[model samples]
Target: MAYENVEVIKRLFQRLFRDEFPNLAPAERQAFEAQLEGRIEGLLRGAAGDGKPTDFAGIIGLGPEGVQPFEDINYPRIKPDFDDSVIPTQLHAVAELYYIWQHEQMKIFQVIDVLRRLFQLGQLRIQRGPGARGLYILEKWKPLRYSRRDRMIAYRRAFNYGTTPAPAGAVVNNNFHFQLVAFMSAFAQYFRDLMISEVIKGGVALSERPFGSAATIQRLGLDLRYALDRASYGNILALTTETGQYLREILELLDTPDIKRSFDANTKWDVVEQVSQRHLGGQAELSQRAKMAESGRRALEYIAANDFSTTLDISVFHAEGKALAQHAEAWIAAYRMTAEGRRFPGVERQLRWALGVGERTARQRLTA
Candidate 1:
């Protein structure tokens, strides 16, 4: 599957570049293909391990020795109730979402905290230029130092779909995957913060003093701009293209007649609810899943509408942020009830502290 994924990526790049440079000379095209293959090979070699499955326990900081292979950790098996030809594919998609949610819960919060601190320290300024409402201008920008091991863990979590290990080098050398994830994290924060600002202000404010005096919008703008500048146009196009495809696949699975019948679901959203409760966590609720599903669909439509343009649509951003924030908040509550959260109580406490929420308020929010 790892090799298949690499091949898929190669095909995507080939199609993208071919369309863009349809008039390339035969010799030039040959050289381009050769260089692309070499670059892909180099990425594979740069990762730390040979192409072997990673240890499950070790990757998540459980222990030195791996108790199980990463590939062994999978979504719950659907019972053999009906035609299940697409079950494996559906489960794979859900597992990817699970992986992303697990990491995003931690990483996205870290980004928010960083921006919150910068705001408190007066390091972020509100943008007052024309057409910059509810936006900020970062006073200074610094790349967050994410360790190689951490990056490898994230890579494996997202890409280790088959028995084979994912490439470690794929996360190294500021590769496209790394940049894509970074942009996503930043974007999530931007939207999440925008939601918070809107909630605090109760609507769009006429004043330019700063919406809720938050630094998220500003930092998000800078971070996105920085990511765009660093990444190639091809990389951006590929990212959007792949993301849209995955979203469509997931949505299709949710709406598939066979899947709905297998789960005895009444509506497409019911499938989401069932999957979330069974595989995501015990606390996964119907309402939360609904929000996530709706926002996901909206996101897919937004990507389709934008067509790979890096343009900011504030209204769309705010709407997405609002829905995603609600989902994240619910997810956090659910995660706290999980075994992992029980083992690491400080995680929530640290987040609460960073967000300047008192214990009472945190408890109230969780219970609410």
Candidate 2:
């Protein structure tokens, strides 16, 4: 089923860019279309190893095709703000397709590492910022938005709130490049949105005061921050399955300066590795003095139970570690501000955009 979506996705791309370059001469247009088709083919091939893009796409929507993949299921009771569009439409579909496909087929760490490989293969550039974020540049796409200040060149809206044009030197000549940029831009937006929405769903309101009305703000704030401590620990444990190398590279590339500073390299790796070894099959009975000894016992038991070549089924554990890391970062930040009685910088508008939800209304539900 996943493989079938590959062709469907390819056809979608073909239609999107077909003959969109009307200004080109006849021969030039034909050549451009040929090259465009090849590039689209390559992109699909690169992503083909995992299952269909449509499989993951189901989590977000019915897709461009109106098919519901899963059966009747009940999701947790969440606030009205949570929805499929927590991510941008184009980007959300692509990310879910890519991440879910890879996650279903590979080890958690391998899935995480693929992001760097994709960036290299697709000719994308990542520029780290001073915060827990970074900029993804499709360097061959289009000129960046610019401005003049004191007769000096300046980049206007450089970040563009997660969408920006290419730098000073870029090739905006071909229609194919433009479409590639569009796809990559959407991918970046999806990545940021996932991190944010995950944090929010874990219950830390991004905005100091959620929009709609004052009466609901305090209640929402209390409910939103309700799970901060749990979320922090949960994301950390989930991130533990990721290899030390994978974690380091991703943190640096994604410009998570805050997280980078939180722990030294050795400590970071040790924590994740220890967690992986300790919680392979299930949690050890917690004891005050035997924590390390208990972990060793678990590791030995795991080795004894499995053949040397067989990979242990550690997906659930790995997922928890990754989730722990992501939620902790956002949760910690939100927690500190709340602790100090500081509001979350009045980001109601941005929060609305991120959640894909409108003004507060009735509660809604979704299936995992």
lDDT of 1 by residue, 68-155 (tens): 4544333222234222122223223333333333333323223323433444565534234321221122213322234334433433
Candidate number achieving the greatest lDDT relative to the actual structure = 1
Residue 135, model 2, lDDT: 21
For TM-score, the strongest prediction is 1
Note the clash tally of each candidate.
3, 15
| Candidate 2 CA-lDDT value | 0.31
Residue 97's lDDT within candidate 1 is: 39
Model 2 lDDT per residue over 1-368, tens place = 24455556777876767547666765465467667767765666555433333444555665565555433211212224322212122222222222222222222233223333444564323334432232233223212221112001101111111123434553221121122222222222333454576587784333232222322222222222222111222112222222223334543543344323432324333322333343344222222112222222232222122222111122222343343334323332432243221432223222332223332421231111
For model 2, state the Cα shift of residue 69 in Å: 27
lDDT of each: 0.40, 0.31
